[model samples]
Target: MRIVHDWLGPIELPEAPERIVSLAPNATDTLFALGLGQRLVGRSAFCYRPAGVLGLPVVSSYTRVRWELLASLRPDLVLVSTGVQRDLLQALFERGFPVYPLPLPQSPYGIMENVALLGALLGVSEAATRLAQGLAERYARLYRALPLRRVYLEFDLGGPITVGRGSYVDEALRHLGLQNIFSQHPQSYFVPQLAEVPKRGPDLFIYEPKPHRSRPREKVEQLMAERGWRLPLVVTGGDELAHYGPLFFGYLERLVEQIRGVLD
Candidate 1:
């Protein structure tokens, strides 16, 4: 089937991709959620979700690929996401590989749309639609009655990274009736000024510690204390906010509960 992807342009995809290779964590998670995990032959080293995908051959990483191993896998379709993987997609396309690039979602709705788009590409439109609808329903049921509070959210991607406008994290926070202190920033992700954080007068601090490089609550408190900030803190310990997958909604639900506890 021929489809014009926003990033990949006009391309022909198989009616049903039997042997698939997903190089992005989100795509890998989506494929499994759609019940197409058996079709995957290769995955990136970072696609460690559902625990079962770890059994697949790791033919790629975030920015590098094992050409020989990928060639040996002989995937009929290769799934990748935009942003960091844009150059990888071009390289695969030029090498005559059937590569599809999923755009980086700007909002929660964009994530749901990608689920539907991926389903259509693999001839599972019905299942994809149902999944998207279910995700929407779940999002709607999230607690939004908490009193509005100014929030400062940071991610530890080796350093202090924060979300702003046009990011799914920012949108999700707003959906929960919390105002992001950096919501007016034009960029999606950027290094936040530590001085500005205290000046923002946030009622709560949501810190997503780097995955695998775990930082305990006491350590987080010490770090914040050094900055002379003693705001209520919620340390998210995993890649739930950093990852754009179906599991993200579940994490958001948990976050709402956490925030309620912190505020109350």
Candidate 2:
């Protein structure tokens, strides 16, 4: 079948890809959600969701791939993501690997579109459509018309990182009736000026602590105090927000509850 991908342009794919390798965590989750887990011959080390992907051979990371191991997998199709993986995608394509690059989503709706895209690529468009519709319905139910408030949301990615206009987090905040202070910025993710945060006059501060680097609420509060941030705060697990998969809606539910607890 022939389809036009945003990044890869027009491409041809087999009717049924028997063996697949997913190099991105989001793609891995989508593939499994589409009930195509059995066809996944390999996955990145970061693809730990659904618990079943763990057994697959780890052939890549976010920015690098083990060429020898990947070659051994003999995958009929290789799924990748844009952003940090752009270089990896170029390399794979030049090597004549059947690689497809999925764009990093700009919002929650983009995630659902990716589900549909993957389903179409794998010859399961009907299932993909159903999954996408279900997600949209679920999102509608989760939507709340809360009092709008300005928020400064930051992620601890070893260092401070925040989302801007073209990011899923920014859109997610809008869905919750919260305005991201950095939403006016053009870039998706970037290092924010610490001094400018307070000047933005956000009503609340949301921090997603780096994964696997657990800090107690008290410690987090202490750190914020050190920075002179006295605004209401909400701490997230850093997993679900960072991952734009089908499970992101679950995270959004938890996030809404947290925000309401703090604001209301």
TM-score, per-candidate, Cα-based: 0.96, 0.94
Instruction: Highest TM-score: give the candidate number.
Output: 1
**After aligning candidate 2 to the native by TM-score, how far in Å is the CA of 66 from where it should be?**
0.7
* Local accuracy of candidate 1 as per-residue lDDT tens digits, 1-264: 787877668888788889999999999999999999999999998898988898999998887999999999999999999988899999998888899988899988888999998998898999999999999999988647567899999887788999999999998898889999999999999999999988888999998886666456777899998888989999886688989988899889889888889878
Worst 10 residues of 2 by lDDT: 210-219
Candidate 2 lDDT over residue span 121-161, tens digit each: 88899999999999999888766555789999888777789
lDDT of all predictions = 0.89, 0.87
- Ten residues in sequence with the least summed lDDT for candidate 1: 210-219
Collision pairs in model 2: none
Maximum-lDDT candidate: 1
